[model samples]
Target: MNTIEVKNLNFYYGNFQALKDIGIAFQEKIITALIGPSGCGKSTLLRCLNRMNDLIEGVKISGEVDFKDKNIYSKNIDVVELRRHVGMVFQRPNPFPLSVFDNVVYGLKVHGVTQAFRLEEIVERSLKATGLWDEMKDKLNSIATELPLEQQQRLCMARLVAIEPEVILMDEPCSALDPIATAKIEELMFELKKKYTIVIVTHNMQQAARVSDCCGFMLLGELIEFGTTSKIFTSPDNQKTQDYITGRFG
Candidate 1:
């Protein structure tokens, strides 16, 4: 079933339109990769899903974003809860200055989960799910930022899972990691899709090929083509998609 559906979506930052009549649906518990050149509205659209763009000045969104059959942009929708349901992992690892355990449990606390036992359970489960528990379990009270960038990124993922979100949005998550680290994260994404639908914005074609079930090509604020990853890379219907996949200018 489709977990997220966008219809005729439009976005603008100041006078410049960043997304134009974009529409797509993300199936539940699957990986959808957004591929495009820089400034192609991939990240902008991703941010819109969780209303992260609302934080930027002069940002405006129009049309519908249906998440699990509910319009997330409706006036009555709780923005905080919407974000909690659709968690995000940024390109950079952004662990808080506090202890690793505290960072993982931050979202639950923010949403009024006050029980220490429950918080510990969530942190343990989340860290174990993200494959960070064995390494960090003993060091839960240590500053998380002190970890390497790759571990920090996994920690960020663990933090997102701690909130028990329905969808996980990643914006160029491997952009800052080394090749080995990137491979590990890609493998982790395959494992994660069993529980959470994933939307990832990636500049690396190989990474998308490796991790995505579906791929969408965007250009200059427009979604030009979307289909199964094999079809997109093997025999794209759109000329632009073909060019981009063939190492021509994106």
Candidate 2:
């Protein structure tokens, strides 16, 4: 079933339009990748899913972004609670400059999870979900920033999982990692998708093909085509999608 739906969506930055009348539905417990060249509004659309764009000054958005059948842009919605249900992971690993344990339990604490036992349970579960528990269990007290980039990225995912979000938004999540690390993260994505709806904005076409069940191709602030990953990569109906996929142009 669809977990989030966007209909007639438009977004602007001051005077310039960034997203043009976009429409798409993200299915639950699956990976959806948005792929395009730089500055095509893929990231802008990703931010819109959870109203992250509201943080920018002079930004305006219209149309409906429905999460669980409710329009997220509606005035009655609580941005904080919406964000809790739809968590985001940035392009880079952004672990807090705290201990590993602290980083994993940070969100839980923020939402009033004060019981020590509950926090510990979540920390263990989250780390294991991200495949970090075995490696990180002994180093819980170590500073998060001191870990390797791969571990830091995994820790960020663990942090998000700790909050038990229903949907996960990843913006170029593997851009900073090495090939081996990227592979590991892709494997983790597969595992995570069994429980959460995942939307990723990626510049890497191959990564999108390998990890996403469905894919959307965007260019110049418009989504040119969206379909199953197999169809989009092999037999796309749109010439633009075919060209982009074949590397004829991006």
Give a tens-digit lDDT track for model 1, residues 1-250: 9999999999999999999999999999999999999999999999999999989998888999999999999999999888989999999999998899999999999989989899999999999999999999999999998999999999999999988899999999999999999998998898899999999999999999989999999999999999999999999999999999999996
lDDT per prediction? 0.94, 0.96
TM, every model: 0.98, 0.99
RMSD of each: 0.9, 0.6
Query: Candidate 2, residues 88-184: lDDT per residue as tens digits?
Result: 9998899999999999999999999989999999999999999999999999999999999999999999999999999999999999999999999
Structure candidate 1, residue pairs in collision:
none
Clashes (candidate 1): 0
Q: After superposition, which runs of candidate 2 have C-alpha atoms over 4 Å from their true positions? A: none
Worst 10 residues of 2 by lDDT: 241-250
Supply every candidate's count of residue pairs whose N, Cα or C atoms clash at under 3 angstroms.
0, 0
Q: What is the Cα-based TM-score of model 1?
A: 0.98
- After superposition, which runs of candidate 1 have C-alpha atoms over 4 Å from their true positions? none
Q: What is the lDDT of residue 108 in candidate 1?
A: 90
